[model samples]
Target chain A: MKPLPRIVSVLSAALIIAAAIGFLDAAYLAAKYFTGGPIACSVLDGCDTVTKSAYAVPAGIPVAVLGVMFYASVLVLALVFRERRSVTIARLLAIAGAIGFLASVWLVSVQVFILDALCLYCILSAGSSTAIFILGIAVWRLAVARANASDAAGHDSTAGRLPAVGNK
Target chain B: MSKSSIAILGVVVLAAAGLVYLGIAADGGPAAGGQAAIMTAEDHVKGNREAMVVLVEYSDFQCPACAAYYPLVKKIAEDYANDVAIVYRHFPLQQHRQAVAAAQAAEAAANQGRFWEMHDMLFEHQGEWSGNANAAELFAGYAAAIGLDGDQYRRDVEASAGRDRAQEDFQSGRAAGVNATPTFFLNGQRIVGPQSYSEFAALLDEAIAQNR
Candidate 1:
């Protein structure tokens, strides 16, 4: 019911969206490997270039495998939270999501600028992560509000009155 | 905000999440779209067990490119023998005069379960058999050199069955988008031109990891 909780819920939804993108990328890779068909990549020779590139696989596993892990982790971070710790947890999740989003963006840049190709799924994953990061920042602001409210309410004796960025 | 407000937010978030999932699952996505042509030599593969990797080669015995690639392909085949299945498909170009005939001879040997042996012999004496002058004599000698039933080989070479098989292989290569000699398909993905052993090994490693 609190503002912080509402913001956390929104971020959780965004995290799920990113995870969905990751799942789709993984599924497409699976289908291409087994069926021997043209992988409909978004960019020119996207499928061929990306799949054939040495960077496509890391540690003997497809890069999509790692995308799925990162997205799922973000989703879990968003979904699991106690109202008492909602503010702190949401902030932590947002910071992590931003880091992940930047990483994805870097990868997409490499794919396009260096590889001279675009992988649709990679684009989607990067775009979704960026969205989640923005949503996460909003959640972090709400957490700052919650912390400020708790301090003002005399609920936490050890805390000082913090800056009021927004109503909790 | 009340408990009802919280409940409404939860419902919206969950619904949006479901929609996101549906959007992603709507199509098979980018990775499963292109269809690479499968080579016909895939049929001659009598080995029951599925190989870890199939090296489908489009080769012309008399073509210089084919001759150049011969050693690399041989090295790859030997290095990855049990793990990789090598399917040689004839891709005799019109420029190469005796390539079709050489391919026919190889096919005839294949019928007698000596396809690979005859294949090696053809590559070994590419210069002598590649010319029109002594092709038959050189081919017959190769048949004898490989300990084939020389008389039957001569008959089979003249039968047109061997020639037909070679034509079929050439057609298959064309269908698979082979424009030049020594085009290779490693597990159905075309790996163009002659590359180092390490390159082939690396690609094969990726294919095996994918299979696992």
Candidate 2:
């Protein structure tokens, strides 16, 4: 069996870590929102203001819940790609990462320009999602590179192949 | 899905649940708010200090949410006056320009033993001075209206004691893990998600029962 590409493993691992971190951050915020209590801020103190603001809950759902869902999806997709080396899962990871990235941009904008306060936990969440997005782009570039190399050499890239059935 | 995939997902789900549990337990908490839940000689108390249920509120005078909850809190203070002790603390936000000043003014009133009067007055008239440039002056007038001695009120409002008092509460509230205004802790545990008057009373009842 061929060793999986170093790039694939590295990027997948990075995505998984970032997504897990994002999941924790989002989940913590969601819990605090549900409790309707004060938010814990070890670094920055503006989270309570942000969370208590009207913007915290939109159309009845706390924004933190959305974050939890998004990060959870990323974690799952990254896991599938890591295990099966499935190109479909990788592509989906990239897509989810793009979506999360866009969401992060909007959230950061809300904090800096609109809310005028910074929350340490919120910033952690934003950083985690941004990292996943960057790793997704890296995975995408690797795929393109593999495709080009395969075209020149007339040999299929094993790195992009799906894991064989019954091998699990 | 492969067996390993199922296993991985199960772990993620469990971890998520554990995090939530930690939040409720506040395993590392009793933040300054929780630790300081015990009343002090300097605290502004509005009910039976001997009551078993102590409801501490971290609030800002200019915050709309705090103002909105003012009546609900006022009602709670009255309904549970004998069963609950309501403690007011300052938590002025940076966004609201007049919040800190209002808090300081309330503290000045506190020096004259008129904290609650100033607190209620500020909330009732929040609309008048929320964004007004003359908020401090308006607060001084309120102080006078609330029957605080003019000379003492002015001295208290202008002196470092007022600012220090407000800052003290602000820091304590922050230590207690409060970020927003009108954050109420019924018996030192935060009151989460109940917006109506009944909902608050229900929690207080639970606390009262627990005490007995």
Point out where model 1 deviates above 4 Å: A1-168, B1-49
lDDT of 2 by residue, B1-212 (tens): 56776787787678878988987686243333575577877788998999988988888776666776889889988888899898988777776677778888888888878889999999899878876778878988998899999898878777787777778888888787775566777776866655788888888899899998
* Candidate DockQ scores, in order: 0.02, 0.21
lDDT digits (tens) for residues A95-129 of candidate 1: 87788788787778777556544555667777877
* Residue A160 lDDT in candidate 1: 31
Candidate maximizing TM-score: 2
Candidate 2 contains a number of clashing pairs equal to 3
At residue B62, give the lDDT of candidate 2: 65
CAPRI docking class of candidate 2? incorrect
